[model samples]
Target: MKLLLTSGGIRNASIHKALLDLLGKPIEECAALCIPTAGYGHPMGSPEGAWRFVTGRRSICPMVELGWKSVGLLELTALPSIGAARWEPWVRGADALLVNGGDALYLAHWMRESGLAALLPSLEHTVWVGLSAGSMVMAPMVGEAFIETRPPITGEDRALGIVDFSIFPHLDHPGFDENTMACAEKWATEIGGLAYAIDDQTAIQVVDGEVQVISEGNWRCFAG
Candidate 1:
């Protein structure tokens, strides 16, 4: 699978280019699936938030609003009861999966329950375009600091571990006081592994087992 992990969605031309490169095609020619499950897991995520993302109404995170050939919603919570036979094909057929932001653990929990985590290794041709928590869910772990949703719903900060490093997204955003460089450094210290602190204009791309940073704003890497 091709990964374009971003702090925000394609906020600049470079990230958009990176996304196009991952898709190997234009946005207008590709089919996409909008996964808004992550939002439901956090206070930041609400029905209005999910609605904005699915309908392409968001201003900052422009996942669904990117003008794809076609866009469909793939809520992870619903996949469990529907059976794999009905939903697996939809995943296999999409060119890219546009995952939303909110809570990584909540998203990770659903990914496991919905069987999407196990199925991810098989989607070799697909592109995963993630926003904030959407991207964090791909990392090894988000650390306790990022764990907003807790307990029986999701007990750990650990995610899929598909990627070798952790991510501190939304760095230096005016809206989030805790998303500063100092906070990221503290988070990185807890992670004790390779991690990237990226602002909204930055992105971490992984393809063919190689990771690359693509940015138009600010970013830094902390090595273990």
Candidate 2:
């Protein structure tokens, strides 16, 4: 499988270049399916607030800026009742799956419950592009030490385990709450496995289980 896991969405030229390289084509020729399920489960101050947050955050601007041909938004909440086979057409048609960030555990639950997780491994031609919580859910376990949110509905700590390591996103990001280098350091030690702490400017690219770090800023890996 090919994966591009990022602390944030495609943020810089270097990351953009890396993504294009993975696609092996110009962005203008690529089509992506944007999954915003993680952000749906996040708690805002109120229901209206949450709605606004989710709606406002749902945008294909980044991909459009990169010259992608088509970008479709697929919300997980709307898919649980639908048959998994119904989604195969969309999944198979896209060149990449762009997962947005919010609550990692929530995303994992839906990915499994909605049957997306099982279908992903078979998508040999589709690149999995993850942003923050989207990236974190691909690991065996998700570190919650730095996340400021309500507990997940699934009440499970383990993730999809598509990748063997854990990821700590937004390290030292001043704009976010409870995200710091110190928090990442403590979490890495507590989790006791291979972990990466990456800033918004960094990404981890895995091609057939071979890991590569693509970055223009700071990042660190802790192996315990």
Candidate 3:
């Protein structure tokens, strides 16, 4: 599956280009799935702004829109519990999935509780795009700083483990200087997973079982 694990959202034209590059050539041919912005701490915002900005600039956003067949996972929260009738075809026919940013922990629970976590992996052919918390929740563990307002990590708090490594996105965000790196180092030691330190505008693309750095900014890959 093709995946773009961005540090956060796209910050500029160059960054947007990298995302399209990671995904594929004909942006129109690819069906897009957009996870709601509930997790990005900007529930009222549009994580798609970055996407629309880029694709609109290229005059190709509508081509990728899946018409009425597209589904939003946030809306699924309102659906009846497990015993309810099966979901619509668009939810199942989605060719690509974009998990936007937000509270990593909340997103995790949402995924598991809503059955998206289980359902997603079954879409082996689907391209999964993750940004910020969207990316963090895919990793085996999340960095501690993200839980500043929450309790400590417990076994139940662990992420989906889709990505074996722990990622520290928005490395340029203030208050995470030397001490934050030290904290990341400590977490790396304690958790025993590979670490990624990526700048705000950077991203890493994992495709066909290979990892490559994208974006115009700098990044570092740390191993335990």
Best by lDDT: 1
Location of the lowest summed lDDT over 10 successive residues in candidate 1? 149-158
In candidate 2, stretches whose alpha carbon ends up further than 4 angstroms from where it belongs are 45-65, 146-154
Give the TM-score comparing model 1 with the true structure, all chains together: 0.97
| Candidate 1 positional error at 136, Å | 0.2
Q: Rank the candidates by lDDT, best first.
A: 1, 2, 3
**If both were scored by lDDT, which would come out higher, candidate 2 or candidate 3?**
2
lDDT of 2 at 15: 86
Task: Write model 1 residue lDDT over 1-224, tens digit each, in one string.
Answer: 99999999999999999999989989999999999999998887789988999999997888888889999999999999999999999999999999999999889988999999999999998999999999999999998878988736437677999999999998999979999999999999999999999999999999978999999999999997
Q: What would the per-residue lDDT of candidate 2 be over residues 161-198, giving only the tens digit for each residue?
A: 99989999988887766678888888999889999999
- All models: lDDT? 0.93, 0.79, 0.61
Q: Please estimate how well model 3 matches the true structure, expressed as its whole-model Cα lDDT.
A: 0.61
The superposed Cα distance between candidate 2 and the true structure at residue 190, in angstroms, equals 1.3
Per-model TM against the reference? 0.97, 0.88, 0.71
What lDDT tens digits, residue by residue, belong to model 3 across residues 142-208?
7665653242355344777777787877775676574356655666676666878776667777766
For residue 48, model 3's alpha carbon misses the true position, in angstroms, by 14
